[model samples]
Target: MSLIAWSLPKKTQLPAVSLLGNLFVLWFAPYAFVAMSISACLVYLISHAKSQKGHWVLLGVGYCISQFLLLRFLQEHSVDLGLGGSFSVLGVAYFTCRDVHYLVESYKGNVRKNIVTFWYYQSFLPVMIAGPINRYHEFEREIQRRSLDFDQISKGIERIIYGYAKVTVLGNYLIEHKIQSYLTQLPNQESILHSWLVSLADWAYLYAQFSGWSDVAIGFSLCIGIKVSENFNRPLSSKSLVDFWKRWHISLSSWCKDYVFTPALLITRNLFIAISLSMVTMGLWHESSLYYIFWGIYHAIGITLCRLYMKQDNEIVEYLRQRFWWSSFTRALTIFYLINASVFIGLFYDGLY
Candidate 1:
């Protein structure tokens, strides 16, 4: 009698482990997990229906409308679905964006015939929460060359450590100290310096929390031999609000530029209308609320003005640019605008006013 032994390939091991991690994440967040599974299945089914042109696009739009309405219903009823009263779908926002990308590309006959690969690409746990949204073409290419070199592993580990430090140390410290609460009370105290301090703290805290999460996600994907796109790139140091957007949440911005902005511009043949459509879609994608619409409009105005300024051919503007303090002044102004505009992100129903 003989006992049989089985072993997995070196390259297959990371994805297998990742699948286990995905299972654990699902176990922890059952509601979000179920929602994700259903969405994945829907995309999978729709992918096979080549005869029906643009069906997946219709599905994507329908899903967005449904999610928006669900959010509104939940808000109106004061209901907590899951995960701190947010949408029960953990990565629905990211998931939908990916689905749209896949569908559009597939519709153009760019995708391959690999269901398992597509499944892993969609439900990969690292980016299931917040995303540096991955594209199927790049993901598939990476999967083919997956390896665990010492250098890659070390870089991945370093990213994870740095990201963990940012989130657990700096971000938590700011929150524990009640940065927002302090900002709220500064008006009553009438302390201008205190208000500035709290505002700066809030800004730093937001960057740490978001960029930290992105780092961790990208690091994990790297460990698994996939290089997810970078989400943040020293956005705080941006010279202009328009430059800030180009460096911040880069994957989402790229997606908007490629899928939404380009096509909208082509159809409308107007810069302002295209910018409005792209910005509003991006804003609403974050959360379904009138506040987000306003936030989108606010940024649209800022970006448009920046573009206009850059396009202007004025001697006064040229002279100002030559001044030693000009760049510093512009940077300072950009940061001030960012903080003021970002306050709208926290506003909801009553807070909207």
Candidate 2:
């Protein structure tokens, strides 16, 4: 069935088939259906509202509330706040992003308003769970331009294989098992190498897991004749923290830049505060905890410092460049800083501290 679908060029068949398959999977949790339905309805209303500015504000507030509730649920694990009993909304966080994109674009009169297309874009099963969060405009364009070319199909297949390998092999083995075990013994072992090893493994593990999910989502989207966003591109090779974010989680980072950072910067007229707020929002999106909060603040400071450093005079930059090992040294330092930060995130996630 999958092989035949891969070979076929019928655009309509894929959505029908994919939608039905996702519906079947969604049936396992009826509450998820209700949640998505409610979310979709709200999004539709926001998209079509007469007072779009007010509606957008209302939608934004609702979005934050939903995230807070979900975060609370994840933390407590046994609390019920009426959306669903003690279960995370399957794709609530991702959908919130899509919802925000739809609302903001529609309000700005930038997106063509189509109820049918909006529903399809919002609920597209492949990218729903873990997204390279597709924009409505881009998604619509891809759908219009979709073709079942051999190159696209082959690329999709290769991405799927690579993504599967990343998740199952590198993520599962190197980090989840081996490195995880090593970290658990770090305190007792009392070795700097062990600490560094844990941090390094965690940084790699996070990239492998999240980027693997992104690859799988992108690969499936491509197979179905859509070109969703790419989420990562050699983030570890980044020369600076600012550049690292540009390459990592491309979807979310771009989303925040467009929807949060830019607007906040305009409103507050303060780059530092705007950048800090963006980082904080990104961190909280992961989970609501002191650890995640600190993670966000930490990145914000890193980025702010980088920005300040770059503002130095041209002479200073030229002098620094004169040193033969300056480039290599800076690159290694950036990686080291990221790894150091990620160690805390890993420990937090694993409940090690």
Candidate 3:
């Protein structure tokens, strides 16, 4: 930690503080949630939440209920009926719902895509924190016929090392300077400048913090008999919001697009209502905060605008691509910008409630 900070000039080291602060947060945030999750797990064992997806659902619902009870005993109220605990419950529930819906869609036929067992799925430890959020089908084929070449091994290890460095080293600054008591002293209503800075740090923190874990998970899975999906691509290298979505936190975005956006759109051609409702639903899923709700609408509005505007010109993306300088520049800035916005959205993650 000191070595990397020493490499940078003195002034640049402030972010280092925020990174470190976030590291501590990451380290300690899960104890309460994990205990609740385990209790949920036991309930699942005793009850009949039999399928892998079913286990996730039961676990999620039970965990939330358990958390509610605990908080209530402490004389605290839930932020919503479902929040003030790990966000993973929502994620697990969503995946379970997706799995069940998929099975129903397939009419109980050959719906077996990912053959990896539930034990392999949930028991994998890395994803329990932040997530790449893999789908069940992603593992279906690979688990059945998995192999790693020499190149794969080398690359995987590199990814893991890089990821750890990102979280521990890069994320250190964000945690130390930002996530700790420093930011809490600031007013909630921040200026555009502070918001923007927070935005950048937030993204950097998430990247180093999350992708770092993801890389470790993916690499470890590669080492073991199990394998998992990649969560991020060169997301910061996206040219536009659409491209950014395509690259960043792919599993969550794709799941949202598939289950939320498409279904909402198909239900009606009313773009405004459909998109707004979808974003609101997405918001509620995360932590049921007004901030997240607004955050959802904000992105949905921006994305919808991008989609509408893009359709206006036949040569927009193609033209941008040919103008290599513009494309690359935009992509780079955008990656930072989107993550920055993400951080602002994540403001609520600071345990405000």
Candidate 4:
């Protein structure tokens, strides 16, 4: 797919190729294609609408409807409003984000009014499933100036290799097969050490699995001369809960910051409320469940506390901040907090008490 896109005769034809490729991929999941097509049409029409007093309201309504459908599809597993077949749209969460991003950017006069380009952005195959959520402007620019080069291909292949190793070896083999199996066979699964180990393993497995796929998506994009946004950046090594969010799932976090947090902050003028709303939105983006809601709130509280602590002017705090080992200590502390939180959430959801 990368080769085909890269080898296209005219750069102007890139969007058409991308659109066709995405449609081809979606053909396997016809219902998803239909759903996404409808969304694309709506977004295009909204983008082309005249600037009016109710423009923002229209965008809000469309966004809310899309999110509602995402949550409903997640809960019900199908459209099922007399749509004959019982099939749900695949990658609904991702494509919805893409559409909303396009709509918002279009409103801001940042995107072209080309429907083909819009559809290409919405259905780009590499980031279609697990995305770094490439912005439409960046994608359009890349499509125009893409090249078939050796160095880029080699780097792309290397990234893909690293991603596969992380997914298969670290996530599947080391964690799933070895560590989890050993834990399962433990005599005292309720021990503190056991719990901590489980938490660490689970966290590692999730990072490996998610970052691995992101790496693959990035590699594929790079192969075609389009550099998408990165998804992760050593999140476990972050110095605080606040810092962790800046590194982990960076695309989504940044998106929420721009689209949710900033807007809420502007409206409410309250730091805690903004952070809480943003985190909850991020959490619900993964799944519309109480577990994820609490997961988001847990992190939001931690982040708020971290932010508060950073504002402290105490001498002891200053002394600690100036120490060489302070960063290492804080990094470890952050990882510990995240691990325990994950464990607690897992236990709560699984009723393991």
| Candidate 1 residue 289 C-alpha distance from true site, Å | 1.7
Clash pairs, model 2 backbone: none
Q: How many times do residue backbones clash in model 4?
A: 0
lDDT per residue, candidate 3, 43-148, as tens digits? 3343333454544544544455455445433333333435355432323433343343343333333344322244344433444445566655565555556543
Task: List where candidate 1 sits over 4 angstroms from the true fold.
Answer: 1-8, 68-87, 175-198, 342-353
lDDT of each: 0.74, 0.77, 0.56, 0.80
How much is 88 displaced in model 1, in angstroms?
3.1
Ten consecutive residues with minimal summed lDDT in candidate 3? 87-96
Arranged by TM-score, best first? 4, 2, 1, 3
Q: Cα RMSD to native, each candidate?
A: 4.8, 3.4, 11.5, 2.6
Better of 1 and 4 by TM-score: 4
lDDT of 2: 0.77
Error of 2 at 309 (Å): 0.6
* Among all candidates shown, the one with the greatest TM-score: 4
In model 1, the number of clashes is: 0
Give, for candidate 2, the lowest lDDT window spanning 10 residues: 1-10
